[model samples]
Target: MERPPARTPEGSRKTPVTSGLAARAHRTFTPPELIRNFCIIAHIDHGKSTLADRMLQLTGVVEERAMRAQYLDRMDIERERGITIKSQAVRLPWAAPGRDGKTIDHVLNLIDTPGHVDFTYEVSRSLAACEGAVLLVDAAQGIEAQTLANLYLALENDLHVIPVLNKIDLPAAQPERYAEEIAHIIGGSPDDVLRVSGKTGAGVKELLDKVVAEIPPPVGDADAPARAMIFDSVYDIYRGVITYIRVIDGKITPRERIQMMSTRAIHELLEVGVISPEPIPTVGLGVGEVGYLITGVKDVRQSKVGDTITSAAKGATVPLGGYRDPRPMVYSGLYPLDGSDYPLLRDALDKLRLNDAALTYEPETSAALGFGYRCGYLGLLHMEITRDRLEREFGLDLISTTPNVVYRVTMEDTTTHVVTNPSDWPSGKIRDIVEPIVRCTIISPSEYIGTIMELCQSRRGSLGGMDYLSETRVELRYTMPLGEIIFDFFDALKSRTRGYASLDYEEIGMQEADLVKVDILLQGEAVDAFSAIVHKDSAYGYGVSMTAKLRELIPRQQFEVPIQAAVGSRVIARETIRAMRKDVLAKCYGGDITRKRKLLEKQKEGKKRMKMVGRVEVPQEAFIAALSTDSAPAAGKDAKK
Candidate 1:
């Protein structure tokens, strides 16, 4: 086999001589030997996971046929749903075959991250762990909002980005257009972008070669006091916290005593390992390597993400780079659907907390849902992932309420309080309340600008600026309160743009504004967790939609219910769910009494799975489905109708 002669494209209008776009900035470069670290990032459904599977196969980490969908995203929801919920790391062995067909060993540490806006934090976490990134832009879609978001994060981390336009097998793939977009967006020479089809394995080798050539190796004093940056963590049923770290400056071995800088906790290493796809023995991992460090830390609480691992004997670099505690902006309450499983819910959460440091929970009691835990997350996706994990992994049924963000409010006594639970909201507040705001970037085709702007304006979003990507493409920036976009902004953007719009947002800061946490009442009682801090202007419209969605979401029950949205003791919008006029009352079969009781028990169990929004009980799936592009509009329209 011979290397294909590389052809370079000169300008934006360069005609391709081969079947695909030509490579740019082609040069012979020294490949790193001691270290290799890179991230696989792309838009949703753009084959990041499939390419990861190919890398594993080419590296002999896993047999070809065994590779499955989203293998690195091993969670049941991720695998089944075909979306990455968490970032995963795997170390593969690549070899350059000699002329005699022999092989020389090299290492490739790959971090696979989710591409959705909901998981942007996870992408940032993964980017911080790597020195290089592989940007996979869909050939048909060109550069999307999330593609730019991930690329910007990589550039912020000073990581060398090797852009690869993927999905070349499709008939509509415009590789040349995407390549130019990549160069323009990243400010890199167009010749440096690699074109590949992750599905058919075309040009994948060239992409691999570029990874080895373009990405730099780790450089640090190997003999220095041991220090590592915790990027990700997993919990083992038998073992404790299995922390994933990149040995930044020194070597760590099994039984090594280490201190975590964030928590200041001490622990002894129990074992060390790497991701082989199949169980592989631990060969000593040194500086620049990515692997797992198992510790007898009792609980996963001791080993947290962004925490520093250093030698206990001699304190290492006082503070490591990329160490920041994750603050969860969205919070909700989680309770057992069935009252009998209350203890089971607690036990499952405690177990999950051992591995998932992102999820934070505390004891809370709800009048209708009974004993439960109030949980916090980085965003909506983070909250949903935890709930899905609880139900799928531990086989425990859970009831989760509508997510709410923390609000800073002044009381009548002139004291400031951070209110998370709506129950903590003051009944007769007279001073002021503030809500978190975020800077959002939306990318879409120019044709949908009108619809996008109109939708945003209706949601209380203020436009910042609009920049042209090309003649027909544009990027819109807005500074909107997180409260305004938390509900259906993303869904609306996708709907208005026909699934072509992409959105990314980062928390700007909390702002002093006219906002109130309006309580939603279903009957007479308040569902404190369903309360939201909203602007006064849109309160009535949002409230109407809120109850309309609630009416559709709540199951028909034995009792009639009134769904009321209230602000400062006044009802702005209301809806009533009529009581079930017909329910299975009597059984005609001779032995059906036991069967009828079982069916009723199932119905009760189903009712238990709903969230008590004020007095209205809404199903849990309704919350997840509310984020879709289609149903969200129905929720809005039904409210006023």
Candidate 2:
């Protein structure tokens, strides 16, 4: 094979390729052989996962007939909910070897990351693993908030950016207008934007070719100490922790010993393979190759997403720069719907937490709810998934508290404590308490600007700045507390703006804010499980609404239930659950009476499944749904959370 001459400049060696058997023979490329490691990034429902499916089909990674929308997001929750919760990887052949006898196949490594603003951390982690990004923008919803946020991060990581207009199959998709907007706002030439319909697989091949042409291949010392970035990970019952990594410097195989640089735990590599929709046969992954490594280590204690996996042989020193510790930003308490299944709920979270680094749990006992978990999540979807997984996967019914944020409080002796439960907060503590703040961006059409501003103001959001994208659309920035935004901000924004508002945010840091504990009292007794931290202004609205929802959720018992909303000693509102008035009202006789009595026994069993907070029987969905609603309840209204 004729070798291409080295283009080494200034006292530099040739391109470092990993493989001991292959000598320093220059590898030839004819446009198609050059692969670009890129990730498709977008906001939730912006069609990133859809585009990925189209790309996989166009590149022959998956059969077109077998393809599903968001094919890369394999989780049941993800498919049902239509969101990408975890970042996934897939390899595809970009083109055939050219007629010049060059291998036309370029292995395009594609990483599909989550688009929800809450999962921005995962998006950033995936970005660190890629050298380029295909920024997918909805043609009708051109350059939404998450797109801009992710685009800025890609630029920050020094990744080559290729903007692609997606979802053009929709009649409303305006590709040219979005292309022009991208050129104006994001500073990319309108000609660089590729228009493709991820649904119909239209114009996808041209986009693939553009990816091969525009993005550069991975460049680094292949012979150097083995180092790879653990961009994402998943836990399998059979294989244990499977980490997705890109080999930056050296080869990795099943026999090689490796170490996670962040955890300092060493392990023997059990298996090494690239991501095929179906698991492929074991193959040695070379430098610049993205693949999976499964070590039979059952404990995901140290192996984390965003951690570095390196060869323990050469003792690599410096760790990757972008390793950010996953912090559970939203905290909530969960109890089993049936008291007997408390253990079942606990075990499910423990197993799920192995794959989900963003999930955290601690033992929590409430006077009203008995034993449960004080669990944490990246956001609301994460919390919902945890709860749903418990019920659906583990066969355990659960009752969860309203989610809260961590508060930094300083004691009299200058000791700092991070508090998730407001009930456990130090009373008369002689110092300050700080809350986590985030830099939020909202992109919406100009028609709903007033409505969005009002919604933000209601949630205590302070506007930082605004930029006009066009005469009819605008991007607004706000620095607000994470606690406020995590709840119903997404839903409320969608509702008020008529589903046109797209939101994205990142944790800026913690700021000292005046936050007070709002408690929900049942029968004049405080329920430690239903406490939250809230800004003074919105406390009444949330507290009163929560009280009303709890009243409706708690089924009619043999005795009446009192539900009260209070901040400290001041009571804002109250609701009552009346006792059952018509229990077994019918009079019966003979064998039918026995049958009716047996049926009543089963009904009692079902009633026992609900948690008794005073005289109220609280249902699971009540706690989950009520936490995110943004409205105050109507007088004498019956509602569920």
Candidate 3:
């Protein structure tokens, strides 16, 4: 039998979804008491998505034919990378055996979140919408860095965390050992930590029941005026803007006039629905319910993440605790290959900002790279993914400059100038220059402690301490400059630790350092794109590496070209590109020695005369090549530090 659409009260009508995205609409207004809101948090490849799939199958929301791995990951980039980049929400119907031998049908709002450190902001957003979290750990890998990081966040938010050990069926699975490890951090008995195999679906049902039994229901007043927190939003080509919200008080129904508490802009709700692996229009979304609302808005700016939504008539005077804006840790220059596509890039960024709230950008023009925008991101992975998405989704070819962190340069005049790009460094810097710092945590094998300590020390890291998670696994903590790890630190750590290390970091604050800007000059002319800021000790190495790279890239001219790396007026490193010479003695092989000498002398004089009148012309390709690599360090990698 087919289930009909939800029926509203006699006087009120439920507006239908008109964007052709409407599915079988059977969900009605679920009460706050019966609805359970929670999210899955774990390390990368620790089985969060797989466990979500098992739950979807057991709940019967996703049929057998529709089943697939990482089903909640809806983007091509996500599927190709085999990681969850966005937080996906789906409603599941379940009937738990009640304590009194009765069946209790309840609603489960499951949010599958990304596990990578770069998308921590995404995880935090998911946490705000839920009342509890499922802290998953791999039985074989024990506890990783991200697991602990997320666990702390859940505890901070006061979300009830259910510790789970996944992949218990593996050959090397040590459930007893790791469960005790998790228990140490979460403060519970080892047996209390549930054991389950996401692949075999052994204990997922019991886990679900525990979630319904332990996680407290969200508190709100249904009789109060309508107010919802916009947790996430996306722009659709066919439907304009679709905002995902969690209602904190009252109810939201279709065709109701709503006003944004932040912007005070009024909009009519076109359709209100819940996602049950598909869009299922609901009669109304009451308190404690998580759903999406569409206003038929074509402009993307109106729907902002972390904005509050309330009814236009008799709305709540107070807004819910929304969210604090995420601070960007890295900055890069994103420029279109074609100058005409500047507007298109802007539009793409605006739409992307709706999806990724951590992205921040401002218009910037470079003499070497032309017009572009300086974009900010949470980390290197976030920057890479955003650039990749722009080129693939928008069909725009772009050139990205080297990534760097923001610096606060205090001058002698008691004024401060913040610099994101190297060219912004002032000439007369007399005060302390401060840079951002992060508290880095690394979980690795106990055997690699010596090598890891050496690596961290080489990067100017100060050891915080170390703790043994198990007999073989150790957790190392350090306070390091954010710029040091922005480039190839993760790759280096993986290589040195034999691929047995996991890293996570959070920005703490800024500290003053002895920093100076190094500029790349060709024949006395400074190239703005090749400028970078480095420590006084590493300044010489940076200069030599970059000057050498420029020497190989720039073609040999008629006259000798001098490449120099300078700190203000003092030049630290220099390289000379020898002029291309014409073989004046090739045809005179058998000629007299005096004749050869005379020809060489004549050639030298001619070259000197030409050198006096000729100037070096640096091609655009050379600038592109030099700027593309963040630093051509000793390892010879491009576009990364």
- Listed in order, each prediction's TM-score against the native is 0.80, 0.81, 0.91
- List, residue by residue over 1-641, the lDDT tens digit for candidate 1: 99544211100111222211011101111123535799998877788998887776666655555656556776667766678777878766655543456655456789888887666777888887788999898888888777777787888899988888888899999887778877887787777778788778888877776676668887767778888888877665545566788887777777768889878888887676555543322544577877777774557567677878887878685768664556777878887867788888887887776555667888898776678889987776666667778987789877777667888888788988888887777766558788888888888899999998999888767899999988878999988877777667777777778877877777889887787667778676777646666678878877888888778887776556788999877899898887654355454357757877887777655554543432445565664343232333222221110
After aligning candidate 3 to the native by TM-score, how far in Å is the CA of 265 from where it should be?
A: 0.9
User: What's model 1's lDDT at 30?
Assistant: 14
Residue 539 error, candidate 3, Å: 1.1
Clashes of 1: 6
Angstrom error of the Cα, residue 611, model 1: value is 26
TM-score of 2: 0.81
Candidates sorted on lDDT, descending = 3, 2, 1
The best-first sequence of candidates by TM-score reads 3, 2, 1
Candidate 1 weakest lDDT stretch, 10 residues = 19-28
TM-score: model 1 vs. ground truth: 0.80
Residue 453, candidate 2: Cα error in Å is 2.3
Q: Report the CA-based lDDT of candidate 1 relative to the real structure.
A: 0.72
lDDT of each: 0.72, 0.72, 0.86
